[model samples]
Target: MVQFEAVLFDCDGVLVDSEPITNGVLRQMLGEAGWALSQAECERIFIGKAVRDERARIEQETGQPLTEAWMLAFYVRRDERLRAELKNVAGALEAVIAAHGHTAGRIACASGADKAKVVMQIQMAGMAPYFEDRIFSGHDLQRSKPAPDVYLVAAAHVGVPPARCLVIEDTATGAQAGLAAGATVWGYCPQGHGHAFQGLGVARVFEHMDALTAALNHKTSHGNLI
Candidate 1:
């Protein structure tokens, strides 16, 4: 059986059910900025991407650069809305607790969001206790997900060798980062992106949180290090 020393999770879609809410806010903010996009379009474009990358893409596509002041305003508005609307993914907190129990609390969140946003979301979801002082944000790295830098840094911070870390991600970009970091990656495809994740080198895919828990238990029980 494969051994794992730590569990690294992607924050937005995996732990907190904030993708839909965040993407909705993004759509509105971009719409007001003269980029009218449907929710699906926003998700397709921005999900799992770092803010800098998204900003560059938007500027390229719209032929207009967003001002720093406007970007700050968007962040303020998004954070305000997320504070009012964010919720934990169903069964996600339970899975985290269980994973923590199994792994002896070697858990860390690595996300392609700013640290402030990550901390805010985790605290708002009541999951700050699980990841307190164990969070790694894209802003901490020169390159974010789909580039491997953040995950590699996260593995180092957790004191786990990349090969001995198990990364749980909910998007292709995040899964790719895990793989590139040399970790065994499990894609949580609750919204039915199983095929996409499969193509991204995920070792496994689970559509439900319970399935993920069971998989972790089975792996550790079969001589895999927790």
Candidate 2:
């Protein structure tokens, strides 16, 4: 059995099903600002990145400074759109509940989003109760995903060693963060990103949330090396 003490989850694509909505909004906003990226391109460039980092990249690429007021407005619009459109990823609640059952509540969220946004998304997706007070935001750290800071902090908060945590991630960047933190990372590749995740050295990739319990059970039964 893989000897994990905790399960850490990335919120956006993994649990909330908000990536398409958020990324679509981002694509529209950036297009209006003259970046004009397709939705797929926006996901490629921005998924699992911090908003500040994405904004900085936009500024650098366009040679146009995004004023603080403009950024604030952008966030407001994004949040409003998310509130209206976000839903839980298919089978996400059941998967989380199963994980919690196996780990005795040793589950937490380590997400790239800001804390407020994370909280709002989870609540909207009907997942707030499972992760209340156990959400760790990348915005809290100096460096976010792909840097390992947030994952390490999350493991610390949950009183688990990095090596004893299993992170559920969707994007390569988030998987990299878990790996860098010395955790076993599982990529949930429902969108057919399995090969991309394999390239990142994810321990396993599942294409559906319904497979989560079976995957964990298999690990527990086999004690497989991550």
Candidate 3:
């Protein structure tokens, strides 16, 4: 059995390779509404930001009403488009869930993605039942990633202490959040990472699920790899 009792995951870049597609959809949606956002602007002003923050920024930038109706419309459109293009991220669903059940560990998802959208994506990908009861969204916490709220909540919800929980994350913000919550944070740095996460006190860096499996196996010596 693995020594760790709980596993936590980030949703977007970690669970699904949907960041590029999500933003691409966003750019198209806003462009159709007559507001074309630059790439830098899309990344800088967005990326890991919660919907509330994004809506405020959008209204501020475009001098338009980023109202509830607009939010609903964008969400509906993204959901419609994303279900057809759901891309799995680097063995995320398979390896993570496999490790969880293989070792009797409780697996939870803590993500910067909003709650509704996270549910939609997970449901669409058929990964919901694996973690539905343990899902933790950024919108539920006062402070998002890099602040520790979401990860801490996840650890608590799954009945594990921060130290006994392992967080699998793919971004600096998410890794920092996990570490801040007092957990072992592993940075999953696959190819084409836009930002570097080398200096974030990550327990280890792995580019693939095989490396992650090896690291987890070495860390937990109680049993052989399953």
Candidate 4:
């Protein structure tokens, strides 16, 4: 049995179902900017990534400079769609509660997205109370996911050693960040789409949030702790 002192969650696909909404808005905006990508193409490239992180690719595809003004516009449009359509991932609330109880509330959300967007999504999903003041955004760090900056910061802020943190992530980029930060990362692969996490160093791949809650409970029932 393994012990974890904290639980770190990646917000987008793990906690809330906001990716489709955000990606739809992104695809629409990119189309208006001269890159007419299908929804699948857009999601394939941008899911679990911050828009600015792919500035070069976006510029190359759109044949236009990636600018702050464009990003701001995207944020505005994305947030508008999110506010209207965001929903908590199935069993996410239960999973969060289980993790919180398992770790005595030493839980934090560490995401590669913008802080405002992350905060808004959590609030919209009614998870603000659990994650309030404990949300860490890579946008505020020197480096984002796949670099370990945000997860490291979150582990530090939660007063847990990175090695003793359990990170729940839905993307390879995020799982890599958690692994690089010295945490045991679990891949949350809802709908059986576990391909992205393949070859990634996640300790487990689960198809639903309920699986996470059950795992946490199993660990507790088995008295698995250092």
> Which candidate number has the best TM-score?
4
Regions of candidate 3 where Cα sits further than 4 Å from its true position: 192-195, 217-226
Give the TM-score (vs. native) of candidate 3.
0.84
**Candidate 2, position 60, lDDT:** 75
lDDT per residue (tens digit) for residues 49-161 in model 1: 86568777788666788678877887898888888888888878877877787678888999999989998988887778877799998887788888888888888988989
Candidate 3 lDDT over residue span 73-190, tens digit each: 8788788778878887756666666657744758888988888888777776668878867788888878987789999999888888999888888778788899999998777767
Candidate 1 Cα RMSD after full superposition onto the native fold (Å):
3.5
lDDT preference between candidates 1 and 4, better one? 4
Against the reference, the lDDT scores of all candidates come to 0.81, 0.83, 0.75, 0.88
lDDT for 146 (candidate 1) = 89
Weakest lDDT window of 10 consecutive positions for candidate 2: 217-226
Q: Scored by Cα lDDT, where does model 3 land?
A: 0.75
Per-candidate count of clashing residue pairs (backbone under 3 Å): 0, 2, 0, 0
TM-score of 4: 0.94
Candidate 2 lDDT over residue span 109-188, tens digit each: 99988888898988888777877789999889898989999889888888999998999999889999999999999988
Clashes in predicted model 4: 0
Instruction: Score every model by TM-score.
Output: 0.91, 0.91, 0.84, 0.94
Q: Mark the 10 consecutive residues where model 1 has the least summed lDDT.
A: 217-226
Q: In candidate 4, which residue pairs clash? A: none
Candidate 3 residue pairs that clash:
none
